[model samples]
Target: MNTKLMGSALIISGTALGAGMLAIPMVLAQFGLLYGTLLMVLIWFGTTYSALLLLEATIKSGGGLGLNSIARKTLGKGGQLLTNGLLYALLICLLMAYILGAADLLVQAASALGLELTFMHSQIIFTLTTGVIVACGTGVIDKLNRLLFFVMLASLLMTLAVLLPEFSTDNLSQVSNSDHIGLIKTSAVLFTSFGFMVVIPSLVSYNSEASDKQLRNMVIVGSIIPLVCYLCWLFAVVGNLPAGQLKEFASVSELMAGFEHDAPWVGGFLSVFTGLALLTSFFGVAMSLFHQNSDTFNQNRVVTYVLTFVLPLVGAILAADQFLSVLAYAGIILVFLAVFVPLAMVYKLRLANALPERYTAEGGNVMMVFALLFGGFLLASQVI
Candidate 1:
């Protein structure tokens, strides 16, 4: 009911749904339904805990410092440099990944409507769309993002409803191809799925007036929505496709291509859904980058808009054909900053003081450290 609560919900949901939703079925099909579903729960909670730990650290450092500031305070100059470099890289790569995805989706949507366009044309259109939105400013971006979020949610639910009746329980039992190694690698998808946790500190600092209890409840409830959506989505997608088909497609677009051949209208609708989802996601990350860099760049709105949009557009153009690969790269970088960095910040904060007596996790710093290490291990395993 609180406006801040609503904002937090949007932030969490917006972050959670991003391009990750589109990849769930493909990822799960490799690992099967049960193992994949269980892994999703584990990763979701781990990401949620990591987010809370980051928030606790943010609160301790007077609540206004972004990831860079916290890193500097807790981890010193080296930490600050590492954090800034990683965050900048992650944000840029993430922006490029989503932009390329959006371009691809636009190309798909146009083809569905009998409008043929080349990938380069689609890239130009997407770049322009993003640039216009960024130029309009953050308030406009936020409002559009919320509306697009609902569109994505409705589309996901609608597709699930149609696919539910066709779900096969037997299909859910298909085993992962890579066995243990494959499962761990697939978990990379789940881990980076929650990479938006970086935005929590910004959300908390912006809504500084929110009570500790309210913030905690907001994070829990906000996170649950996406986790549930992912589970439902996984069930529908993995249930609908055969194990053999899933392995052939490295990304969701490839999977949806099959759906397009069988169910043209549903696939067309999904193309639109995928496009909007990626657009809103790009908007969120771009806005965050804009805000993060605004203070450093003379507070000039035009300059901020240009740097945020143009630089990423160039990166996206360079990565036009490698959308999924770019996403994989971004995921690895995000794992380091989103998981390990936050965990370290929480530990440092705890040792410095007593967490302000109102913002301590259960079991104090011990549990927090273990959680971080566990998440770190999961993330590291993916790279090795």
Candidate 2:
């Protein structure tokens, strides 16, 4: 594989594998492993297709613009304004979720080592420690993100090794009759779990010389890796605990506590994996948010960094207990950016005959209609 392609794919995997991975089990517990897995596969396909749609629009506009610019070019000022607003809202929700998660992990780590720390202290420590790398700009984030991605994978494998032995077929056999309602409730967060499309424009800008094929490969490979990982995670969790026990976990800390109680040895590996997942995901979202601010403001770098991190940091602090809620809301905003915005741009391009000749997203007008209906279903699911 090209090194650039590998690095870029890691970015998408890293971003997609974050807080939503932590939150999925919470929503899926009542939904059962069989139904949850099917719903996830559906979402994976929907999100991956939407990402390719974004790629087509980006390529058509000459391949170096942000979503805001792409929206303006393809859909006019009204489109730009809507895209800009949704982009900021989505990024902030993601950052806030990550901050709260990392802080909880920090507190857990401190507790294991026989130290006590307040959530506020942990939030400050996590935000500043990771926030510095984000502030240093894309090169630093890219390098650190790649390194952490590998380390996170190592921890995931180790954690899985411990959990898979305890897996039972009986645990996986349970079914919920309300599977359809469960799918409706969980669709938003599940879709958000695959919400790496926000970084597609950044990937295009970072690899300016990358051919259209390479960009599409980045989205596909990057996203598919996380799909596999998430399934593995869901299997391990469901196979061990059964639906009733899984339903008791309201937060990541509680989930870790359940593992610790059942198999004491798994806690260490799971903690390491969870912490790395939060960090890698944080870098991807924060970097893209930083770039969006920099481009929009064209201000001093310090000012852009502040604009990117400050609001989310404060939101995280105030709502430290609301980790799952924040992720659920981010899923709502993600529907706008990931599905509707890209669908609109590509639809407009096709009507104008402005789509690039060499590399268009597959599936044609039929796919566009599917995307429209899918986006509406997710939005209505979350809202209703």
lDDT, residue 83, model 1: 83
TM-score per prediction, in order, is 0.91, 0.96
Q: Candidate 1 on 1-384: residue-level lDDT in tens?
A: 486567656767776677777766666677677678777888888878777777777777766425666777778899878888898888888887777777777777788689998877787778766767766755565577778878878887777766666678887787756486677676666776666666676677666788877777777777888888878877777777787787677654686886766555567567656776677667667666776666335467777777767777788887766766776777778777877887777777767775567676556767776786766767766776
Candidate 2 lDDT, tens digit per residue, 60-133?
A: 97754357778788889998889899999999999999999999999989987899999999988888778778
At residue 223, candidate 1 shows an lDDT of: 82
Off by over 4 Å in 1: 114-116, 135-138, 176-178
Q: What lDDT is reached at residue 152 by model 1?
A: 79
Per-model lDDT = 0.72, 0.85
Q: TM-score of predicted model 2?
A: 0.96
Instruction: State each candidate's clash count.
Output: 0, 0
Superpose all Cα atoms of candidate 2 onto the true structure and report the RMSD in Å to 1 decimal: 1.5
State each model's C-alpha RMSD to the native.
2.3, 1.5
Poorest stretch of ten by lDDT in candidate 2: 174-183
